[model samples]
Target chain A: MLTQRLANIVFTILLLIACIWFAVIAQGFEASGLLASSGLPSKFFPQLLLAFTGLCAVIIAGLYLIKGQAGGDSGETVFANFAEARRGLLMMVVAVACYFVWKRFGFVPMAAVMGPLSLLAMGVKAISHYAIVLALTVLVYLVFTQLLNIQLT
Target chain B: MYGDLQALMTALTHLAQPVSLLLLVGGIVLGLVIGILPGLGPPIAIALALPFTFYLDTVPSLILLLGIYSAAIYGGSISAIAVGIPGTGAAIATVQDGHKMFKAGQGGEALGFSLTGSIIGGLFSVICLALISPLLAQLAAKFGPREYLAISVFGLVVVVRVAGKSLSKGLLMGGLGIFLTTWGLDELNGTERYTFGSYHLYEGLPLVPFLVGLFAMSEVMIGAERVLNKIEFSDSSLKVKLPGLRQLSRMKSVLLRSSIIGTIIGIIPGEGAAVGAFFAYSEAKRKSADPDKFGTGIPEGIVAPETANNATVGGALVPTLTLGVPGSPAAAVLLGALLIQGLAPGPRLFAERPDLMYSIFIGLFLINILMMFIGLIAIRFAAKLIMVPTSIILPTVMLLSFVGIYSVSNSFFNVGVLLGAGILGYVVRKLGYSIAPLSIGFVLGPILENALRQSMTIADGSIVEFFNTPIGLTIYAVLLLTICWDRITALLRRN
Candidate 1:
């Protein structure tokens, strides 16, 4: 069956791996010379937490294996078809692009593009929608900088 | 009695000052705006206001953040009624019937009922708070470190169970959240845990930045998903019609019952507002003479959840103010605000400042009174909020979050943390993990570790001594009973 449930299962598994990696890192954390004996050593809580987290992931994975309800086979996939999934993925790409644009060109310039780019991502082919969205961006910028007196660099 | 009178006078004099009043109203208005805005919830609202408190006195600052918190939860209902989408997670339960009413051309009526129910619920919880908080404070004053440890376990367990659909998911997230807080130098023995040689890591990850990112940034990602797939929708009517006194009086039982239900649910460590709302709603439905009339744009459907959910604000505050333990995610952030203000929550607060307690009690009352007017005015413009595109809203909120986290410490590392937290929150949320346990775990982790270490030191490594205290044992017993709550309910149903 072509379903998002498989993807969800993979997602949880990745998180489990991330937790184990954090635990390994925690174990390597070196304690300073004299102060290690003040309490139950600093690594106790972090390692305990990691073990619990690992146990949880294993149980969750087991549940998915047996019941198939863990990753949610609710038949609620937004990307049930190719076109919708493409548009949604494109929107994420646009948001990431806007982040980089802000990093490079600064807030005002990136903000100017974000509104229209998002509209384009959603397949809104209307000039009116773009105009309205652009106007909103300018309005928000003015309110933040002029009215609220926040310095937008 | 003489010491009590002196403390009370000090409190009264402190609250009588003019700045406190301004902060209260300003906080409410600010909270309303943040609550109305999607992806911006109480944690971000409070975190953004955290630095402003560094200059102001503790009382006014606490009042400001508290007002915002209570009002924001109430404000979330506005967007939930106006649009099919909930403004905050707490309003999620409201969506089942709230959006239904909106579709049937009763938007104005639905908004009115929600506003009225919210105010009533808020007022009821405030009254309960005035009566019960002092009593709890009195009882908690006798507790020691071991007692606190027991209470911490009770609180953490209660929250983990109530937080999500699966207990393992809650445990995993909660464990990971608590583990992350151990990243700085240990306060007790001065041993570094996971600081990685950075001086900025000296104080651990700053609560304000972490909270701002967790609530605000995660929202940006979720908002982006909706942005690409959003359906255009709007409500035409802008007028709200108030329910008559007779109608309100008729549902007084429902309002009272739901408020109590909300308060009790909220008092449980992590049941939170959304859970309280639906629980109250279902309870009302089951008790109703005509259950079939439910969810058909009826007044009862709207009233129960709104009343119960709003009541939760005051209910949630009870544990946070009494113990350092937060009753909900919003209250957890409020705890952070209190800590930033150099005010430690717990029994000392009651002994040192009962007047501050009175102020919160009275403040909740005033917030409820103000809500009647503010909610009515706000209902008219609710449609405008619905029309705001989630795409633009998402980016703007992300910008605000970035600017806000940067403004606090002027450090780029904080911004990186915000982004990291956002991505982490997005992944966990997508994988069906609740953020409440994580947020609550982060807040409670330090307290838990401190109490655990101190209790161990005090007991000289004796495991039996840890649970030897009578007070600690009682709390443990109560917690045990709480965990078996589902079985109790099942037995009650079968009987």
Candidate 2:
């Protein structure tokens, strides 16, 4: 299990790297035509925010490095147990997978698969749970397509 | 005054329409149902309904979203009292005393107090909103880029200060949120900063999808973790028995104080219903004759938080309506609805749409009044609603979010943005960062960037001129004073 202290420390470090990288990318930003000499460069706000975010990430990293915790978090593990962690991470995978499914296979196919896949990922054993989710998906479909006239495709 | 009366009449005419009345009732019922179900709060509730609003008229859309905002906060307490699990974050403070009272067989009475307090608090804040918003708008009419810069900075700083336990973490999230907003072409220069060759990125990340993803999709992921947890509560004590006038008279002081606290907290940027409820709860306990009895089943304990949380609905609208700044995450979603209607939210909105303003005030008042009848009937069925398993809800909400995001623009890229935002929200929350500042930061990002650049141009490279406005200086002064006062109070309490 990943503890919050270690996770946050690593997260902050990665965030710092992203901020610096973004800042470097920001330097390449240039305005064209008559707007080239604008009031402030387009990079100004993003770079300022990058600097602010980077400074905050550095402070958070230092706090975790020295105190083993930031705020009152007290270095607890991020997930309660293996089962809970698996369910959460698996659901995330299912969601991302369903999005790709929608992209490749269409909305109807994605809708059909999403609920049952989520149920499977959560390790749901109840057959009725899958039925209820499917029913609700149909309801969402009717409401959006028929009632609101939204094109699902 | 006559023009105001005319606007009120026009608003009444709009509300008198059958479609408006039906939606008003439907929104309340839907809000209660969603609120009774745990893990779905006001922001998600409003966001879910947002796509539907894309097809609605402005007044009806605003009315629907406002009803959800007000009732959802009130609805959370029902679960808190009956099931010991707060249906929303706002109801978390109510669980200690509310559930205790339910176990002690005073469930109906506790439910009554929360219902009455919520309506009263909601009505009071609506009154405050009606009175204060116009004056604020009048003052805001004089605001230039410098004043807006000050207000935006004030909003971001205040939200970050209250958002999380770690200031650095909050700041990091706020910065990240604002940075994400910088993805589209710059309005000032038309320079494509990070559009990455997509015209979809021209308008920046779509607001509604990002918001829905952050609040709803993220909740789906987190809620998936405990999908099998069952809720149990007795239905025997579910009936609501409202207090008599005499009993109500006795708690008027608590009700009044909590309404004030909630409304005041609601007007501040980034403070939400949860913060208001906890603040009112603590204040009520501190002033109680028997503070020790607070957590052990007391009516005052239930009344304070429920009232304050509902009051935040009206209070939150003050900034959202008058200043184009959202007072809460839920209000930020409401702001999106305003944008969808092609109406800019700010002092100009008040001047341009006096009838809409009147509609909001009158509609909120009516909703609070109607919530009583709706809440009374709804509480009887609260047990069943509470029992609807999370396993069923998580997948449905996830599907709804997916379908809802796709429906808004019929764009696959927007759906992608929604999924990405959900993952970001999930990671941040799991690692212990509140999404309030992040959501608010995202909403305020364009405003912040515009204000800063404009203020810089207006100041002509002089830093001192940026702080030259009297109103801007006063805002900064008040912000400094608030921080110092909080620190001093904390030190005194520690001592």
Candidate 3:
């Protein structure tokens, strides 16, 4: 289980690094012609926001490091146990896989398999739940295709 | 007044159409169903319905979405009373007293009180919206870039203050949300910032898909993790029993006060229904003669939060329609729906589409009236909905999100954005951060950036001139006062 104290420290550090990188990249931004000289530069707002974000990330990381909890967390883990983590991470992967499947094989194949794949990811053993989810998938497909006149293919 | 009456007549003429009427009822039913399901809320309900509005006329679409907005808040109490779980965050305050009442075998009475109080509160706010919006719109119409900048700053800061326990985490998410908007071509200079050679990135990010994914898809993943949890509910106590006039009269003051509190809180940007509900609950408990009786199956406990939560629907729309600023995250999504209809929200919308404006006011009144009937019928079956396993809901919501988002633009890229946003939302939510600031900041980013740059140009590098406007100064003063209000109260109490 990943405790919030550890998670915040790790995540905020990565976020701070990303903010610095993005801010540096923002320096390369340039407007063409007369617009370049008109008012603030395009990088101004992004860099300002990056600075604010980086500052907040630093504060959060510092708080977590010093107190071991930022928001009254009471040193609780992010997830309760391994089972909860497995379900959550697996579902995320399934969601991504469903998106890629739609892009690769098209919406029909994706639609047919998404229900079963998601059911598997969630560790469901009920046959009726699978049937119901599949039925809902078909209903969604019909609503888009027939009622809304959306081209699914 | 005569013009208001004329517009009301025109709104009635439009709303009399069969399709509009059907969609309005359908929206309420959908909202009720979704709100009865644990882990789904008004924002998710509105987001999922946003894409369907693409095929609808402006009046029906707005009507449909408004129906969903109001009823979703009301429907949350059903599950709160029937089971221990609150179907929406707005219902969290209801759970203590509501579930207590259920366990005490007064569930029907509890449901009835919640339903009636919600209707009264909702109607009160709609009346307030109708009376106040026109005046607010007239005033807001005079706002300049500086005023808008002040308003945006106020919105973001207030949201960050109240969104999470850690101010830094909320600010980090809010800043991150605004920073992401700086991608694609800069509107001021047309300079490519971070398009990264993709035409899809040319628009920065699609608003509706990103928002829908953030609310709905994230919940789906969370729901997936809790799939093994089982809910047991008995239908025997599901019937609603209306309170008598005498019973209502006894609690009339509490109801009235809560409605006012909810409306005022709703008018403040970033203070959402959940906040209003809890605020009203605390206030009611403070004012009660037997304050210790709260959370012990009392009618006042149920009424305070239910009324306030429903009232927030109307209060939230006041700023959204008048100032082009959302009063709540749900209203932010509602604003996105308006943008999709090719209508820009703000003071001009009221002047340009008086009938549509009247439709919202009049339509809300009708929705509240109609909810009494629908809620009665729906409560009898709402128990079964609460019992539906999350494993079934997870897959269905994911599929709907994928196909619904794809159907919006017929573009796979938008779907990709949806998936990415869902992952981002899930990650932040798991790490003890609230997504309210993120969503609201994303919605307000364009306005904030545009206002700031334009204000800077108007000021010509003079900081004093940027704060020169009377309206801007007033807004800033109010923001400063709001931030210090708690400390001021604490000092007074000490004294």
Candidate 4:
């Protein structure tokens, strides 16, 4: 139930803070030897972009604070209901978990569990959907490993 | 001209091979299937297939991706007509009249007109690409750093302006995309920027993985949110019927005008297919005898957007191939595919690989022609594709993204970048920002930085001197006009 106005204000403030942090970090960048006297310093472009981005963020924050909308979702919430939010957030967690699983246990285990975990996240109850997804996961594994000679692990 | 002809012949000989022919057909089928699926568009389709291209020769790979590119744009119309939901952003304009016509029990006829118009628009744009690319490349060959800077600015600003309703939000995302590119060792000074002590970050974030994750993985998460929603359609209306020669002849003017509009818009860097479709649709409605009847399931309504959207494929390649600036977001991903092949796009490509250039031109023509036959057979099966449950697709796409990106380098870092990019894309998109400017900005970042540095060196910090070149001035003039066009129209209306 996050409103666009409230969300933009919060996001813009955080973005402004991040831009300042990155700009300070950019000050540490240095060049050596012949590259030292190049056309411009390495930090110039990034800092300039950060400045512009920060400026835009401030403008957006002001627009939202004053007008209460930025021309999208005037009075609507970010998600339709709790179910949609839960599904979306859980899917994101599942995706990240799959990545970590792949990194820790190799490709096979990750591929095997990714589908069922995702189906569970989406609240699917159909057994046939799981079967088809499992078959697809296996097919993908075989194609990459056998046909293309790619090392999945 | 004779050399071009010889190159075309060589390309024809290469495409006539059994392997190339099979990939071409396979690419079209894959493209159509992907296009018919809601939430999967050309960029994602090309991104998923990009890794497979790493295994094949340049000619076959480019041919396969080109088939996907052209057909995907055309394929979007199928779902637009059969259901109210457009499979791609380009097909949104088609839904106004296309879906209405389907409910009127003229589904087959609606599909036919869209298919025919798409083919015609696509073919016309290919012809334009063939005739216009060489000439444009000749002119682009003379461009200097300042000219490139102007072009990069024009491309970024134009894309940001059109990407969403809020300019500030779009610009913020665009700036963030370019800023991310500044990570790693600087190409100009070799100074470490934001590598964070990882050798993998030395060369900066990999393009293919970042792009694939941005388009495909983000859509997967978004699709996951609506997994329970059901798509309903009638299989009885899925048959496709080609319009008679007389029907096509009557709509000749609409087809030609839309083709021209699409191609011109496509040649303008960052305009994209959706803009072209909407513009052509508005123009068609404005010129009609009864503009009020436009959304009431008229043939002209379907034809304008369909033709223009497909035509953008050819038109967009004009800038992408000639100037190294992508004409659309899909073309931006196509640019990544080119970089993966170690082939840099621009005027240099035309000279260095005339055969490849010829192959693209000839290959596009073949894809459009072959799409008509393939679309006829494919329409009957589209209902099944359209009904694919999102729960199944979301996991499959995420898996593909992870595996496909990892296969690129066998590097876990690239996979991490993919996941990171997907999250960033999801957050920004959910906040009402368009991914078009971000993707395009990332692609243009290196070019923009290099050009800016070089131009500053040449100008020696003189701002006026940077604007002295005729070509740069011309590009800036066009950009200025484009920016002020709406304001000028508003002023005239007020007067």
lDDT of 2 by residue, A27-107 (tens): 999998999997999999999999999999999999889998887888588999989999989999999999999899988
Q: What's the residue-level lDDT of B446 in candidate 2?
A: 95
Q: Each model: TM-score of chain B?
A: 0.93, 0.98, 0.99, 0.98
Off by over 4 Å in 1: A1-21, A28-34, A71-153, B1-23, B34-56, B92-106, B228-237, B492-495
lDDT of 4 by residue, B347-411 (tens): 88888889898889888899999999999999988988888888888898899889988987899
Tell me the TM-score of model 3. 0.99
* TM-scores for every predicted model: 0.88, 0.98, 0.99, 0.98
Residue B64 of model 4, lDDT score: 94
Error of 1 at B110 (Å): 2.8
Better of 1 and 2 by DockQ: 2
lDDT of 3: 0.91
Q: If ranked by TM-score, best first, what sequence of candidates would result?
A: 3, 4, 2, 1
Instruction: Score chain A of each prediction against the true chain A by TM-score and list the results.
Output: 0.83, 0.96, 0.97, 0.97
Task: Give DockQ per model, in order.
Answer: 0.37, 0.87, 0.88, 0.85
lDDT of 4 at A127: 98
